[model samples]
Target: MKTAGRQTDAIVLGAGIVGVSIALHLQERGRRVLLVDRGEPGAETSHGNAGLIERASVVPYAFPRGLSTLAAFASNRSIAVRYRPATLLRMAPWLARYWWNSAPGRLDRLGQAILPLIERCLDEHRQWTKAAGTESLMRDEGWIELYRSRRGLQQAVKAAAELAAYRLAYDVLDEAALQAREPGLLAGIVAGAVHWRDPATVSDPGAVTRAYAALFTARGGELRHADAAGLQQDSTGWRLSAGGEDWRAPEAVVALGPWSNDLCEPLGYRFPLGFKRGYHMHYAAAADTAPRHPLCDVEAGFVLTPMARGIRLTTGIELAARDAPSDSWQLDQAERQPLAVPEGFSLRWLHRDGAAPGSASLLTDALATLDWPAGEGSLYLWAACEHAAFRQIRAAARQYLRPEIDA
Candidate 1:
């Protein structure tokens, strides 16, 4: 209890999948790591995903290039994206950069860079899943993207064709074929589906993260419960004092997801990260009644994936303050499915999104002031991501870690 991991080489301040994975990777590099968290690892942001390892996402999900989609977003009624007016206004500039970088040319460049990571995500995931013995948590068959309108299906087909260079395996399912794959879906609502065979899904994302943390600990890494708020930096490196103990490490990694700002701002490393909120609700599931594969309501920008809890209906981006109260309207709109009425364990969740390229200077100046050794900034930021907006953050994030991770 006295100065946990006092002699540790590094202290990772979050226990999400990214932090756990970072701990493991650092251990692989022969660093003795101390992974600290305020609550159970993965019980926060990482627990609430659609649980799809989108191996086939060769192209990133950029901003809608079409005016109709833009207009729909403006209306704030779209199931895929809803925003509180004030919060959206505050986030406009960041959103503008997101829109700007999402231009076809820029997005294509970004996609090409991250293709390797996306390509190898599942195989890498399988390696850990095998090590953690959580292979049962994953489904190798891909997820199905359901298009409500024939026009939507056509657009998707065109998009898929554009990614032919990526050689992703997918089947365009007609109505009958779609029904053949997922008979539970009420017919006539879904016009078609793109069954992407390359990606895989996990039944319990949180459990998978915990499993990874277990693997990290099994390798002689340490896990502790302490508020990252105790973290401080000085001439000696980094120090995190919690309760009666004062822990020290030569370096620390801040992967606290949405809460990264709270700690960073105190340390003079504030960046404009959009703490986009989302929601997920679980419904009871029966074996033969649920869809065989995860079903993404593409038009609605939601996913109804079968999980250990049941069918999890996850909503898309909600551009709000990191601490804003939950708005159930978005989740309510996602309930159009004819499946049995969902009940219980409905809660709003948060994930960090929206990275401002403009904030790079602020980050630079902060580092210039602090002047840590080498390689703190890259490994310290986000792997807590999703969305096309997040991909940009990640692509930029990769820039930070490449030198350190590769070396």
Candidate 2:
């Protein structure tokens, strides 16, 4: 362990994609940023996603309205969603708020509000990929949402009209067209698919985050291992303990994502943050039989994405406490149909207050405001900075120096 008196213009806690992006953007704006995380950047939720930049996600996911859908979820018979009764009980309030926000009118307003941000996701990622020289890790070919039944296809076609209204590009591929595009798909497994052509996919989402962190450090920003619990505010500003040293900054941004509440709740700032835990596992593909694009089994609740590691099968959502013990039943259920024999497995949990898009947009707007009053306490910059755009600038000064350490 080492100790030293260090100071920075802004300290960013949590080095996930959002945190790293915030740190990078602040650095570009000439702020000496210190990015702190308990583990390596992107090693958490950022690394485990389906890897789509989600340009077509103009609309956020709404709570199920149909009786059948609700029944299926309640009975745990739906592959699309699963919940533990105890977890649901604990999350009732947050879930109620989420349900209210998912009303047709509110959902529509949320979609329109998030559309501009969705449109720029690809371009923003492109800039980072180009600068970090991680272009090879990215592909612009988009993704597919495969339907197993005619009803599913019809519902998707109807949704396509709404997507077109937002000027989002997509194509409804019939069974034959789907086969033509992805011959490696299990024969007769899907009726058709909606090809979302605007989003970009990454081979390794975590690696991209690490690359951005590398670029941040290369440009003189600081990346350190720190406990966000130590965050404090006083007449001067913010102070945190990391690597046995006291780090002080006049301004600080908390980008801890799922664990953000740990620090913010202590500081008297509480948002109705919730969690939707998920899981993922990789499998080997037979020779020349890997998927060409990411494929979501719309009704089945799992996605098979062609990743650098292998075919990654990711689960939908599991409502549980953040620290709840892992359950592999979703993975077991998904594997029963033989998507692929799992060679490796991992579990992940996603934390969202309401809808991802809406939550992220609100969070980003809060973070971009720099003149937050110190008397109010340390700023808890939750998930808002994840997709927020920043003026790119490279910093030149290094008053504090530390060797690059990997976690």
Candidate 3:
């Protein structure tokens, strides 16, 4: 491979959803861009996720009653948002800031900051996918946060208030309504529900990713199949070398997902992205017990997404790196469904991605530098849903830092 002598306007590292999205946005803004990734597009966490573009997720990251989760561990399945106990213990100090951010105020601010971009981004996703002709593979169906216990229902009430503050739409469903919505649901299982109509999920997340790449190319943006090794700043701009080629870009965006921190570390700036490795079990379906809407088990800590390909039961997050080996126990635990799956459902014997415990780990040190707290509370929110703390932090940043000028 030889270097493309023309200066690159921007070089984006990583081809995950976020990275690719940034590339497309930059290209649309008329900047020449190059996207680099080690793996095929969408092969990482973004490829295997629940494929949800959740707008109601605007509620801050922390739970309001987080303290209770620490005491009633078993009763608070949802609070165990991040697992990988073995890895977590070793990275405890690094994980502290996340715990602090889970404080009600911090999550609120985080939610507010992100809300503006989410719905618009989702709309863009839909438009871009449709233009690429992947409409059928994408489902506009909503996400259901189900509650079987009274405590669960109370949690929904708090979530409802938070959703309203964000102006997100939701409807509460009783047992009868839920059963009517999904006839296969086990009897006596539903206490209530909060339905988020804004979230759109895709049947095949991979297909969506490929479609984005295709659409980008169709729009005349070049796709380079190469590994981005490093970056060098020069008087003109930034020079990026990869695949035996040296490229220059006036502006650069690093959306490398889990690898973002590592790629930027040498450059003296570390991104605050913790690799919360999630697990998923795809089952060969036995019965036609398909869920039209995605199911979020508040107590089970996983989601049962029935796609055209197969039924995927995914849950649990171990804070590790992109290469970490799958924690067999975590994947095994996914088989234990909190509720009954239609007969014949079973977890895939192996994790689709090669991630396991200790396979790879996130740069947790970055979290501390970012001022995130360490502890369970940092990982889970127990305060009222309002993310007040995060807002104050952002406000303080704006109070000090000057606004960024347009490139």
Candidate 4:
């Protein structure tokens, strides 16, 4: 084990999914790395996210027809990308560009880039979990995108087309087919469904992160508890300042998720990274009435992943400023969004105080807990439309550092 006093070859700023994954991958290549965070691992945006490995989130949320689609979701509050008036105003330019970039061909390219990354990440997750003796936390039972209206279902035909062209396995189901599979849809609520069999779900994201930290330590990587405040250039490398401690490393990687903006601004790496606050409350399902697999409300911006003891209803995408408490209304919307249930079924919210109104549970007590990150935490690796953008940066950085490291 490396003591914190020891200098290392690489220093990772931020303990979020991206940072930790990078550290673990570097360790695999026999590099000595140090991961620093303000608190523990898996404690920030990573702690509270929709736990789906979105092999199908190929289309960016703000694509063509996105504004109108968002308007449609405004009334229901159950769909995938709800728009807050204020945040939308601030994000207008980005939204416009995002929509313009959603040309069919553009969407195809985006999906192609992201799907492979997700596939790779999921595979890596499987290996990491298995090595840490925690493979059971991930579920391979497939994901369902349920449509309540024919037009809505039709809107997703493009997504279906993409899925098929990409050779991803899925099944389009009518109301009958959906009900037969899950027996939870309210009568007439679902017009059709698209089931993607390959995507995986994490039962407990925090537990998984803990397991990964253990694995990383066992691989001879170092973990340090310190608030990553800033970075400065050194003669031969980078100087990282955190928790009043200074350390130098030949290379440094910033995988700080939402906080990337704060940590990178002083270094002239001005990136427009924003936070989309998401909410999920666990609901204790009636033992006899629990849904068997995870379900995505196609129109709803969230997903419901059922666990052995309860169901976790995670939804909403409030574009709040980072570090702000989640908007109560949005979380309520997720809780209140109706789930089609089987006859004679009953469900109740688990963490009522933590929820706004009608929220759903994320998982049973046996699964895990959503403990808040105190001061700092670990990373929860996720992929988004920005994967290509970040990869380009990584590639460029590698080229620049090859001479230094190899020399």
lDDT of 2 by residue, 146-187 (tens): 988899999999988866667777889987898788877656
- How many residue pairs collide in each prediction? 0, 3, 44, 31
RMSD of 2: 7.6
Error of 4 at 42 (Å): 0.4
TM-scores for all candidates? 0.85, 0.85, 0.80, 0.80
- Ranking of all predicted structures according to lDDT, beginning with the best and ending with the worst: 1, 2, 4, 3
Question: What does the lDDT come to for candidate 1?
Answer: 0.69
- Deviation (Å) of 106 in candidate 1: 1.5
lDDT of 3 by residue, 96-211 (tens): 76666666666666655545445464566666677879898777777888887878888777858855556777778888888877776776766877787777777777677777
lDDT of 4 by residue, 93-118 (tens): 65565555566676556545444444
What is residue 86's positional error in candidate 4, in angstroms?
3.8
RMSD for each of the candidates = 6.2, 7.6, 7.7, 8.3
* Candidate 4 accuracy as lDDT: 0.58
- Taking all chains together, the TM-score of candidate 1 against the true structure is 0.85
TM-score of 4: 0.80
- Using lDDT as the yardstick, the better of models 2 and 3 is 2
lDDT of 4 at 133: 86
